[model samples]
Target: MLQSIRSASQHWLGKIVLSVIFTFLIAGVAIFGVEEFFRGGSSSTVVTVGKTPISAEEVRTAYQNQLQRYQAQMKRTLTPDQARAMGLERQVLAQLVTEAALDQKTTDLGLAVSDAAVLRAIQDEPSFKNANGTFDRTLFYQTLQRAGLNEPMFVREQRSVIARLQLADSIVSELPVPQAVREAVHRYSTERRAAAVLSLAPSAAGEIPAPTDEELTAYYDNNKASYRAPEYRSLNLLVLEPEALAKPEEVTEEDARTAYQANQSRFGKPERRTIQQISFPDEAAAKEARARIESGEEPFEAVAAARGLDPKQLDLGTLAKSELFDPAVGNAAFALEQGKVSEPVKGRFGTVLLRVTAIEPGSIKPFEEVKDEVRKEVALRRVRESGFDKAQDAIEDARAAAKPLAEIAKERGLTLATIPAVDAQGNDPSGQSVTGIPDKETTLPAAFRADVGNDTEALRTKSGGAIWYDVVKIDPSREKTLAEVRDAVVQGWTKAETDRRLVAKSKELTERLEKGEAIETLAQETGLPLKEVTEIGRSQSKDDLSPEIVERIFTTPVGKAASAPSGDGRAVFRVTAATMPAFVPGTTTDGQLVNSLRTALADDVLGEFISEVQKSAGVKVNQTAFRRALGGEY
Candidate 1:
């Protein structure tokens, strides 16, 4: 049976029959019962689920496609090591394993799609449709060719995909979500609270004494990692943008004039008219509509309204003659006086009558008036066309001769900038942002990964320019001595001590309030101002009270007190009121919450189903073959 299946797959009609039968027979004994059915046996298989063998080539192809997608997103090519570090191979393998499990289950259930259904799907694909919105055979074939697939392979794959989709839809489609669950989520999210909060400033810590030398030393020692400097690199950058290389003095009068003539349309505005139109099925209907408007039997807007057209549908906004879709309509529209309707005109689509509402006259600046601007424009264009290539060659030649970037810049008239010291985040040793780094996103990462005195590769800019960089010096990160950062350390210790004292003070105050003392009485006694916040939800955060305080407010019962860290000090808040609005079904917010919960539940159910299927079918991985497929050593 297996030999006959293979033989049948060689013919066009037989291939379709094979596909229809493929899912039913794929789990038969001929394939799964024999361990050596694969061409290269177990060595070529990365993973096997039930009767399905996921080959090394399949893994490699999937991995490469994923890598290409990542590269396209980052806008830069990534090395194999970088992809490996991202764990893309593991993600791809896991996804393939899940898909194989699904496929196995589908086959085990004898799921199959007919050839006519697959053909209908192909014809329905929008990518294979022509301008007339019908299937184009040539377009379908061309698209398949571009995707590196033929008719038979695509049909077979599509058949399998549809079958797997059927299995998944049966498991998860339109799963019911309970109303009680929706109400619970809505209540939790919409619950609001009111709290009376007393602010505690750092000074409330009562003038924290200065730390002694022993204390400061111990503090610095305990938090040495915070005082360590980041690794910094000194760099020289050569940027080749159009403006930097443009030399307006080099542009002659004749050249400027030629450029001005070539781009005259860009330097002037064209005539534009605001027009309205009403179309008819034939010229006679258009003529009748025009005569009615001309004879004052009805206004132009009334005529439009009679045809069930709104003002927006009738009015074509201001457009130039070239911008109009139909030349005949455009000509008639432009010829009409403002507020006057045109005669019946036959346009490309149909017959129409046009009304010109307003017109703006065109104007162009004289050559002499814009000569200086034209010269600069020409000079920039000239440099932009070939400046980067020339600069790159000069830099390469200078590097081969061991000349410094500054010297190369002076000789070749390129823009060279020197950054004395910069961290990986483009900050200096003092933590000040270092400005004027061209293409910093690309340059900084490359610079940090480079060795000192080595020429880094040229990076492309968004504006068709290029930047080359060289790491000049490296400043290794090291822990700072207490003396080197004594001021910063003293400040840190003071803040920490102040916060500790403030927390203690807040706790003491909170305990008093919890013990039946009125919050207002305590606030007045402590000489602190108390503010009442109302309608604060779980997600609310204010200037004085942070989200942490808001969370504590919601968690505390009414009339109960809790303490949370605020900005610089701590806040002691007493919950005054709590409210949970009644959940109204089918409200926008309720509907959104219901949809979100339903989606999450559906995903969980589908995931569990797939996992169970995988367990029942059994999954085995050849670690050596998997690693080899990912370009790793066995």
Candidate 2:
């Protein structure tokens, strides 16, 4: 099932990196001198997936894209060294394997997309549309060009993406969230109780009787596995942030002036034009209307009204020249002498006559206009460069004084801030960017271990950053104290109790049902609420079931009784129900069925093709090469 799901999602790799990553990296393209195209290098062979050979070039492109995504999102640098450590190169090669495996499968199955369908899909994409809601060929071409893709490459990529989606939909559509499963999920997601939960906190119980020497010995013997600590290594780390290089002292008035002057365009507004338009179905109509205006007998609006047009209806007043239609359209309008009407101008939306009512000239903004912003920028840069030493000294003094980070910040007039929980993978809150610094070449901080004590002095970093960590006190491994294991033990105990109670209850209920006890009566006796859920289908929301209790009810035979453990040791059940999901009457004949059948047929035969490729290709993975490229041991 997992392999099928993974194969189904083959498109994820080529779906374009997230826009957030793109935004950050695209902006700094000039800073790193990163080339978009694959540069020629001594070609190296990588693992081949099926019959298709995965080239060093392919792996490099994928790796580079991954690096850019990390850097752009994290606003840090990523070096090739760390990539080698994570087996990233091998991972890319694996992706190529998976893709080739699936593509061959697709080809062998004879599944196909028509040129007409591809064209329609392209037209439907919102990114390719003009303001008038039709595909703009020039804009579409330009966008692809910027992304370093050509028409054929883009189309081929799209074909694979669509094919992959078809494959996924085939599997997912068949596996309807079974009504029973849906009910279970719904109950789990939505059911809430007003019970006053009192935590049996071990802390509130006080220093547990310093376990008698005998008790400690017994526990160690019974659960020796709990006492082993995970292997850990302490490493010196270096961190370099943008602010580390910025120094307020180094930002002279002259320097500020120069920066302000050099980036003058950033402070200036684009040239704007206030314009109006009138459209006609064809150029002949537009020309005829223009003749009436030149003859002085008909007003533009009057002639338009007579021709069954609402002259004011299409008024797009005061649009910035850049915002007005396309460049061809806007240029035509701007070039026309003020108050003079343009000749029939052909555009993607048809022909139109444009009149420029006003022109707002573009001008360089005075430094005074953006002085406060410049000052802030200048100050920040300077502080980054000069304040590092002060920050370092402050940290050292704080350690000696045993003062808190807040106290040190207070004295230094700098803010002390906290970053929220980062995961073991180094992911941020969004569960992306395995390294907290997205752009930087860093891996998970191997220094952070479960054993690292809380409230320790700031751990200095190699990147010029420091972490004044108070490890959030997670449950320790077996090697830690017994008190740390108490919660898990109690949780296990409760679950076991619930299961035992539920099994007995189910037996009792089944017996009573055989003897004809009313379901309502049983509910009343047991103090369990009896409620009827209607239209329960394969797609039922899990919230309605409360901890998966509904699965037993739905799966039970209609005339039989069943009970399941639910919510904190409570047992829940139903005696019988006549209604259960079979099939919607017309769905078998629906177009959806045809599509599903096509997909299933394709997937079934795909494995044979992959096997054939495997037989043909002599594939070997150079684990050492991969590890070296990624920068660490495989």
Judging by TM-score against the true structure, name the best candidate: 1
lDDT tens readout by residue for model 1, 1-634:
1112133233332333333233223332232233432223277898898889899998888777777777777776665546666667766666676668778888889898999988887787677775335678878788777666788977887787667667766776667779998877877888888889999988899987899999999999999999998899999988877777788999999999999888776678978999898878898888898898989999999999988887788888898887785789878887889999898888766678889888999887889989899999988888877774686687777778888778878887776899999999999988899998977877898889889877566776656677778898898999888889999999999999998899899999999999999989998999987999888887767645798898888788999998998888788989998888898888898777866776666666665676577668876777778788877732
- Number of the top-ranking candidate, with lDDT as the measure: 1
Which segments of model 2 are wrong by more than 4 Å?
Answer: 1-44, 47-55, 69-87, 94-240, 244-352, 355-370, 378-444, 449-507, 542-544, 580-589, 596-611, 614-634
On a 0 to 100 scale, what is the lDDT of residue 542 in model 2?
A: 43
Steric clashes per prediction: 0, 56
**TM-scores vs. true structure, each candidate:** 0.72, 0.53
Residue-level lDDT tens digits of model 2 in 16-132: 212212222333222112241112222255544444555655555676666666556655554454555544544455455555555665666676777887787677777778776
| Clashing residue pairs in candidate 1 (N, C-alpha, C atoms within 3 angstroms) | none
Candidate 1, superposed: residue stretches over 4 Å from native: 1-171, 247-272, 275-312, 320-355, 358-375, 382-387, 397-403, 584-592, 603-634
Candidate 1 yields a Cα-based lDDT of 0.78
